[model samples]
Structure formats: structure tokens, C-alpha cells
Target: MKLAASRYPLRVATACALFGAIAVAQASVTQVSQITASHTVQQLAAAIDAQIAAPRFASSRWGIDVISLDTGRTLYAHDAGKLLQTASTAKLYTAALVLDTLGTDYRIPTQLLVTQPIVQGRLEGSLILRGMGDPTLDTPGTNTDWADQLAAQLAASGVHEVQGDLIADDSYFSGPSAGSGWEARDLQSWFAPPASALSVQENTVNLMVEPSRVPGERARLKLDPADAFPRVINTLTTSAGNTRSDINLYRAPGDMTLYAFGHIAAQSQAQTYKLAMADPAQFAGTLLQEALARHGIRLKGALRVLHWPQQADIGLDRAVVLAQVLSPPVMDVLTRGLKRSQNLYLQNLLQIAGVKARASAGQVADPASGFLTTEAWGIRALDELLGRIGIPPEDSQIEDGAGLSRQDLATPAAMTHLLVYLARQPYGAQLRDTLPTAGVDGTLQWRMRNTAASNNVHAKTGSMNDVRCVAGYVTTASGERLAFAIMLNNVVREGDEPSPSRTLDAIMEQLAAFQGRG
Candidate 1:
């Protein structure tokens, strides 16, 4: 079912008009706190300071802000207006922008366009698989594989065979394959896949390895979605039973070759590792080819991908949509992605938003006429949205929506202010519900357990090397609603025995237990 107030742009514009005046217009990051507060507030602040001031974290920096939504008052703050690495917490901004612009009822759709009609059992022209960046294309439903569903749709459309080439068109989103500020070394990691418009299995493949019966024999490896995986150079050896399994998978910068070295115990169970693929359009095209072949559809031409700058001859006069599929509601997609901190989903949403941005202010919002990269357009849209809500551009430097880049920075005050602003809008509750509940589910399933914050604090958690951050809503022990953002940077983990998340969790517990002059 669709949500109420589903007219997206209209609602967003209305919100801008309604709250633009309430937005703080400061050009710099600066926190506002009560000059005098009750003892309860002081104790909460002291307790949080203790957690962040530990000797082990002396080298780290923190930015925190906690405000009572009930009274619109700041209870505690520490360098809240300072710029800090946001990590995955940046997803919250992407989520808010899309939710406001696209609405909860919006559904991303894919279309199969063709220039010629099927004649008796064959297509006379190319079959174009046009995508609009729906990230859930590869996810299976309750009983049917998504790929099989697409194949069935094509079959139902009387596509018995294709006499021409199969074209994967991802012109919907055009930008660098890598997000802004993404390092080359991270390209091969599963979490660092390209932000292509056509994504299959999140542009990743799982490699399964089995130990050989002999202690010295090389291990056998198999990659799922064999049609799109990179070449794996195997140097893995099997060890004796009861021995530990040690494996290292390496991929060089700008190269697709994977080097697998190390050993697995003969008694060990099969191991599965997921890694990123190089090109999403190619991977998607290959998967569709395999699916069509299984469905007995004959293809007489080669499979190819058509990205931006590569125009397709659609024969606009006779171009027809053969089949189309709509994703689940955009809000549902955002919820699933945030629960797992899936970076691509957020990035794709931002890309789509950019595609909607106009090349010039006089021109209307159009996805096709922009000269700049989709990434640039998206960042511009984000800046505009923040300005509408009173967040100065100086408070944040947003390179990518997912915050994979160390260059992504946002003041704790900005994050908290964003949360407070969203909480006042009609879709605020929906946005809040998408966040991970402490110690209950999503990325926070294991955190804040057995504490006052357990299952109470709803927030977005950000994680990356040397950075940890969180921001969202929580109701204190006295039933006072609050908005907060906490950032920790330059964190150095000591041997992995203890995680800095514990300190974050401690800070949250203090906030959860606070009982002020309510």
C-alpha cells in the first residue's frame, strides 16, 4: 500500500517553506548549551565525558550533541559544531533527502525498451534492458529468484528469441564508477563496489572454497555467478585436520585478478567470501544472458553494455516498452539498506537525486541534460536541500552519500539539527523507524545490550577505519524525546580485544538514563 501525502516534490517544497525560517543560519559550527542546568544534566555530561576521555583514546577526537526535542533545549555538548568524519552516519542525510523528494510510496522501476516488435518467435532489432538504479534487482522474493522473474517477464512479452544484440543500458546514472574520494586499494573489497546504474547482487560475487582431502593438496574454489567473477589465482593449500584455517585474498589496484593464498584445514567446512566486481553493467548483462539461455530464449548476437556517452539507436519513432518491474517502496529499500549499513543503496539514491537535478536554475529538473557527472549533481542537490533547512554548507563537506571517503565531514551539530528538523516533518516518524534500534536489530543488534539504551535508542551507526559515529532519536528514562549525534575520529583499536563502540555505547547509556527537569 502506498503512503499518505505521497506527492513527493510538492511535499518537500511545502516543508522547505514551512521550516526554512526555523533553521539556524550560522555559517560556522558552534554548539549551544544551557549556561546553567540541573544536577541530572551535569551528571549525564560528566558520565559521557568519562567514557570519551579514557587514556587509550587520548589521541582521538569527539563531537557530541544532545538536545531535548520536548523542550528544544540543549542538555549536553562537546565540540558539537566541529567538523568530523561521519562514516556511514552520512546515510541518514541521503535517506532524508530522498524520502522528502521521492516520498515513501515512490518505487524505482526498470524497463525493457525495444525498437522492433517480436515477429513470430524472433526480435528483429536490439533488446535494451533499461535500468533506473533499482538496487534490489538481484534479491529474491519469497519463492522466485528475481533473475528468473525478469526472464519470465521477457518470455511473457513474446520474446522467444533475439535476433540482435542484447544491450544493457545504464544511462540512468552517469558518473565515475568509483565514488568521489574512494581509494584504489578499496576497489576490490565487497563494500567498495562501483556505483553503476545497473547493479546485480550488489555488484559482488561469493567465492566458495573447499579443502582437499590430502594435507598438501591445493584447495578447490568456485565463484557463484560464474559468468561475472574475476580470475582467481589459487595458491591455497590444505592443512592437517584440527589445524586452523588461514586465508588471505588479495586484489591489486585497477586490476580484477584475485590472489588467493594461505591454507585451510582438511577438517574445515567450506568457506565463502564475497568480493566486489569491476563493472556492474557488464555483470548485469552477463547474468541476464545466462537467465535467458536457461529459459530457452535464443540469442543470435553478442551481449553488450551501453553507459552514458554511448547513445543507443532506439528508433524513437517506434520505441516500445516491452516489460517493466517496479521495486518495493523506496522507504522500504532505505530501511533494509540502513539496517545493514549497505553503502551502495544510499549512494544510488543520491545518484538518482542528482539525475533529477537541473543543469541550470532556469531549466526544469531533468535527468538527461546535465553536463556534470551524476556525483556532482547529487552533491549539489544535497547542498541545496541543506540550505533549504538552514544547514550552512560550511558545516559539512559531502563527497559521497555513503561516506566511504575520508573527505566526508559533518558537524555533530549539523547532524543533530537535521534530525530535529526531520522530526518536525510529516515523514519524520517514518525516517526514525528506518534507523537501527539499539541492541535489537540492524547494525546495532549487538550494541547497548543490557543497558538503559537497549532497544530504546533508535540511531544510525557509522563504521570505518579510524572512524565511528552515530546519530538519531532516543527517549530518555523520563520519556523525554531527544536528538543526538556523536562522532569519534582517529580511534586506534588496541589488538581488537576491545572495540571503541563500547565507549559510544556507554555514552548512549548515559543519555538513555538521564532524567532532567521534565
Candidate 2:
């Protein structure tokens, strides 16, 4: 477990720039004094126990583990192997498997295969879209303009008009539309868009609004990059003379029926809202029509989703092999997924793994196929990844890699083990940088402020009612590196407010300060 020593100077420089000269000088002067590994371990254990016995955390049912990166030894443990619901911490395992199996350079490919060639400015055959499950397909960022570019490619293929229908082939993934544990209420939320074989625009729609100038008239609402979803009726009422507003949108199951609730101030020029979809297929169809219109192409037939290409001759132009679009490597997604705890991104990564595993299984009679279901594939991939780093199977339970399911569980020991493994990877810098810096970004932006760990610790955070977990790497003032996991479950706070997440964060900061020097 040789730690990256050069990072010490760079991190110190950053700390100085962010926290002022006084803090950097203080952190630098704290020199590393010689101490035996066994003695340091004992001291760290006692200090962590003392912190746990403190009154602020007296009623918390939590687990903690500290491992010496210098010697691959467990310096401290508290119910470290107990299984508990991990919430988003499940992404750690998901990221590990993806990094190992897919490799850091693996980019998801979205294919454009030509079925027919243009003849007399008219496509005589059908245009087929074969999806490769790129989650960022329709994301709004500048680099994510691939969908529109793809439209351009189709136009350049010499098909001025499609005589046949525009077909979407989303057969790469074999599973249900959504994850089983996804909350019914959350399904209509942007973060819970339905996962599909072919996902576009992250499977969501953008609702925009502008206040009406006429007195007593309601605000005007419209969809951006419209024509993707079915007609949505905004039944939400706006109040007069109100300067502020709240808005809520709901979509019924099975049908694209939408309901909008909330308020907006009068006379506001513009605002943007996110609306989840109940049927992604219909939404994709609508968008395809709009995009095609931009390129002077219209479907003479209808929209269809099939397991394979249509057998009938629809007189569409022959599809040419346009350039294929590939997503950023697995490491890029992993960093954002774990550090930011993006549920959709993590879920997509898991599905990618499942698809890969099933493909490897080939045409076997066994339904499991080592990856038939998400759990089977996830567990196998996890064990295989950990085995490469010498972590035993008995150390953890990884059910659904997203940690959104209550069935997913892991111990403090296993969590820290993952951190250790990530630190040794060649792309370890990207992994560490992706995690939320203390009190600066992502979930940790508000946590560890004004503490030693404020910017010194970078870790993944998890929350599920009474469960709170933070696991990752922490560098001490003297440059000693330690990996730790502090998980609290079934905590009893004085009032019925959210569990004491901030208090747990404080304790973690204190734990980071324990350099294990006696």
C-alpha cells in the first residue's frame, strides 16, 4: 500500500490557496514523527472509540473502520463487518467493477447503421437507429450534442426524405423498463427516469414557462426541444400578485398523463422545469419527428420499436454506416456517479455491466447466465474485482450495485477496502478528484466546514432515513494517508427531524485528525 507522496505537496498548495496562508503553515509544520505501526494502530483505535463514546453520537448505531495504507493492516474496527443498507455508497462497488471489467477507456458506443442508400433524393428504405445505451445521449451540455450531430449524419448519408418509418432498436439490454426498488412516487421525478434499451435525453422532458402579461390570465407554458412527449396539460393554477412560486409535476403510470402543481410569481419572463416521463417510447418518437423536421425529413409511415429490423420493404433509403458515437470512458462516469451520487448515472453503469456479463455468458440454457438479473451480475462482478485486489468474498454483500435497494448491504471493512483498491489504480487521480471535496462540491459541499477534514478529506456519502455513511480517503496534516468508513444506522435523534447527519460528519472530521501517533 504505497501512497502517492507527490500529492502531499499539491494538496497542501491547494489548501493554502483555499484556506489562507495561516492554515497551510499550520498543516505543513505538523511533521511526521517516528512511531511503530503497532503502537500507532492502538492509539488510533482508542481515539476512535473515545470519539464514538462522546455524547453527541451516544444513541447512534454506527460502524467505523480504519486501515493503514502503509501496511495493509486494520488499525481499528467497530462492527466493521455488519451488513447494513448502504444507500448511495453502493456506487463504490459499481464503479470498481466498471473500472476493472470495462477498463478506464471503455466508451459506450451508439451505432448508426445504414439500411439503404439515397436514390433520387428519396430514401427508398427504412432508417434504423441501433442504440448502444449511451446515457449521456441527449444531455444538454455542450459536449453532449451527439443526438443532433447524429441527425446531421443521417442527412449527410444522402437521404433527403425517408419513404419508410423511423425505427428505434433498443434491444441491446434485456430487462424491465425500470429497476424494481425504484420508489413509485420518485418514478415521476427527473432522477428516476425509466431505464431502457435505448435512452434519449436522459428519458426526460424540459418544461418552460413565462408569466402572462394580461391581467387575470394564467402563465404560458411550453416544452423545449418539443415534440418528444405527448400533449401535457398544465392544470396548475397561478395566484395573482404573488412574487414567488412553487411548482410540482406528476405523470400517471402507464399513460403519459401529466399533472403540474405549484406556483410562480407574476410577470416573470422565463423559467425551466423538469418533467419525468411515463412512456419513453412515445417521447422518443415525438423527438425524432421534430429532429427529422429540422433536417427536411419526415416519416411517411409510423414509429415502431422491435427486437429486430423490420422485415417488410418500406422503401426507405439504404442506411449507411455513419460515424459511431462513443461516451466518455468508464472512469469519467464513475467519478461523477460516486462523487456526486447521481442515481441515474450509477444505474446506467450497472446495466452496462449486466449487459456485458450477459454477452459473455453467450447462448447458454441457464437463465442466470452469470448476469441474467442485475443482482447476479453485480455480485459476480464485485467478487471478481475484489479478488484482483485480494479482498475475500466473505467480507461483503453487494446485491444491487446502485445502493438504492434496501437489500443492498456492506460493512465498514468492505467499504474501506474499496477505497484502498481505488487508490492503487492507474487512474486513481481521476477517481479521487471525482469525489466531492470536503465543504467545496457535490454532497460534501456543506459538510466538514471549518474542520481539519474541510478540504482534506474526499469521500462518498450515503443517506437513507436513519442510515448515513461516508467512506473514502483522508490525508492527515503530516501527509499520512488513511482510508476510513463511518456508517450510522437506526440513530435516535432528540426530535423527529432528519437524522444527525451533520453530527456524524463532525465526528468523521475528528477521526481524520487522529494521526495515530503516540
Candidate 3:
């Protein structure tokens, strides 16, 4: 569905007319108890503080705020305007910008082209794989097997072996293959998908397996595309017990040797599991080569990464456009991106905006025209939205759109301000609908499991090594609506465990139950 607001500039302008004054009042109030004596509001704030002071979350530094959407009143706050690390909660801002700037109905496109024509039954030239940063491409079972699908698409076109090689055009992005600050350990994990112009399958393959025959022998490991480039060196020994089935996937530098180590099937029963890889491009290249060959397209040359020339590299036939595939609307992407906390999708979307940014006049469009090395674009866009609701830019420092960095910061007031702005927009309902409903889904799925907020609240949840944050809208029993942000950071910890998520849940529950005084 299309967003009700056409552009963020206009939306901000309209919202300013509606709640500009209310926003001013909300910016103050550093103490929760000092706010309105509404029994509901006071009790809610008190309960949340109790949780913050509890053993679990008491040691963490935090900022919090709750605002009345109806009256634009600040009901509660704790250093409400202070800056702090936001973590994945940063995606919330990214999402808002995408919704406001690109509209919810926008679809990312990935185009396919035939660089060569079919002379009789043979392909006389190369085939080009062009990308526009579509995250959905190469996802399991979505018919996104670019190689297999393209080969089939080619077979249907009555062409067999190609006289030339398959070419990949991924020059759209020019920088590190991965984002800055990405942990080295996270690279082998499925979550750290390589950011590339021509990415597929989320840039990783799934390895499924079960127990093998020998008591301490290696278990059976099966690759989905079997033809992919990842070569495994299995040193895993299996045993008889569910407790021993803990598996770990690893990759050594300069080698495709992926090692799996774990225990499985003590009773000789069956079990299922997965293994993820660090390099997806090599895997894609390997699979594409095999798939094309299966369709009788023989490449007489070796495949390598090279720049796409303005003209064909080989003396082949002329280039012609074939078909184009586009991704679902931006809102749909946002739903999954935010709900699943998929960093790849969020970061890719950020880069896409960089592509949309205007270059200096007469400078001509270069690689940096639409892309940025920092969070300036998202921050500038968010400032406009917040400013429309009377928020001051001095209140926060936004370093990353996904808030994955500790340098990123935001005040509780700013968070509530944003929520209020969304609440007043024509597409406010969409924004509200996208959030996790207490215990029902997304990051909040396992939280507030049995509380009144379980199904009543729709909110975003954020957490890091020592930080926990939540923000979004809440609908009370009396039908009164509220916007809130709860942030916690620098939690004191002995070792690994910083604090329990339950502490934040308890505080949120109390806030939800707040009722106004007579």
C-alpha cells in the first residue's frame, strides 16, 4: 500500500501545524514523577524506575520518556534528551526515513540484460548480471537462483552453450565489501552478508546435516546448491546425545575450507542443522558456472571479477535488454528488515539512499554521488522530520542508521518526538502496524509474554552488550494512546551477562498500566 503522505517535507510541514506547540512542552521534564499527576502516568513511570533500580538493570545507565499523544504532554522522563548508544534500534530511524523519503510503495529494482544475441542455437556474446541492491535476490526458495533461473530463462529462449563468459556488473558500490565496525567474528556468521552490487542468497549457503554411522565419525553434511564454491574440511565428531549436538561453523583465511565441529544423535535418531559461509560471491560464481553448464552453456574462459567496460570486452554481437525484476515495496521490506533486525537489509537500504543523494553541480555523477561514508544522509533526513515536530538537533548525535555503533545517540524526548510525529502522519497506522505487538512478534515476541502489553502495545526493542532500549506506541485500556522510549546503557556486569531483558519488560508493563488521576 502507498503511504498517505507524499513527501517527508510536506508531512513535517503538516505535522508542525498540528502539534508544534505540544512538542515544545514535551521537550522538558527530566523527572518522571514531576509530570502530570495522572495516576496512570505516575504509576507507569514509578514502576519502570523500580525495574531500572532492580538488581538486573539497576547498574545500567539509561534515558527514558513517555509522552501523551493526545495532549502532547510529557508524562515521564529520565535524562530524556541525553545521547546514548542505540544498537539495532537505529533501524527505526532508517525505516522512518525510507517511509518518508521513498514512500512505502517504492520497489527496488534488479535488471537483467543480454549482452549477446543467440545466433542459431548458440549464444554469441556474454550475459550481464546487473544489480540495484535487492536484498531478496538469492533467498531460499524464492526462485532467486540467479544462475539456475537465468539459465532456465535462457533455455526457454532457445539458446544453448554461450560462446563467451558470464559477466557480473557490480560497480554500483565502491568501498569496503562490508560495513565499518562489523566484527571479524561475525563475518562467518550468516548475519554478516557481504554488501555487494550483485549479491545473491543473502550471500551465504545453508549446510543441512544429520548424524553419520560411526559413533565418533563425522556426520553427513549436505550443501543446498552442492555446486557452490565453499569447500569444506570436516573435523566434526558426532556422539549419542541431544546435549552434544551443539554445532559451530568456521573458515580459515585464504582457504575455502569450512570446518564444522559438534556432537549429534546419541540415540542414533535424526536431527536437522545448518552451516553458513563468509564468502557469497565466490559461491555464486561457482554455482552459476555449474548451472549454466547444465543448460549446455559452455564458457571457454575462466571467470574473474573485472570492471564492466562501456563497450563489450569481447568482439561479440550487440547488447540488448531482456527482462527486469523488482523487489517488493519499501514498506514490505521494512516489515521484515525491522522485525527480524536484519542488519544487511537495513545497511543496504542506507546505501541506496546515498545513491539517491544529489551530487555537486557540474561535478558530474561519480561513485560517491549518491553514497556516503557516514550517517549524514539519514541524520539530515531524520532532523527534518523531528524538527517538524519541534525537536532540536542538539538533542542527539546519529552515527549510524541501524544504531549498531556505540557512538550513535538519541534522547528519550527525541524518540517520543518521532513516535508522535508518526502517530500524526496520514500513514501513522502503517507505522504502528509494523512494530512488534508486545509478546506477539519481532524482537518483542518473547517479551511481555503474558502482560497487558502483550497484545496491546506495538513497539520496537533494542539491545546491545550492555544496553537495552524500547520505543513505540501503546494503546491503554481506556483507549488513550501514548508514545515512549526506554534506553539503558553502561550496565554493570561481572562477565558475559550484562542484564536480563525481563527487567526492561517489568518496567514497560508498569508504564502500560498507568491510569490518570481523577
**Local distance difference test, per candidate?**
0.78, 0.66, 0.64
| Model 3 agreement with the true structure over 223-326: per-residue lDDT tens digits | 76574444676766677665545555565423457666665665555533222344445555566677778877677756544332233354224556554556
TM-score, prediction 3? 0.76
Model 2 lDDT per residue over 458-481, tens place: 888887656788888876555567
Q: Regarding TM-score, does 1 or 3 come out ahead?
A: 1
For model 1, what is the error of residue 323's alpha carbon versus the real structure, in angstroms, after optimal superposition? 0.4
Q: Candidate 1, TM-score vs. the true structure? A: 0.86
After superposition on all CA atoms, what RMSD does each candidate show versus the true structure? 11.3, 9.7, 11.5
A best-first ranking of the candidates according to their TM-score comes to 1, 2, 3
Off by over 4 Å in 3: 1-40, 116-123, 140-149, 152-161, 208-212, 215-220, 225-229, 238-248, 252-255, 261-276, 285-320, 358-394, 492-499
Residue 230 in candidate 1, Cα distance off native in Å: 5.3
- State which candidate, 1 or 3, has the greater lDDT: 1
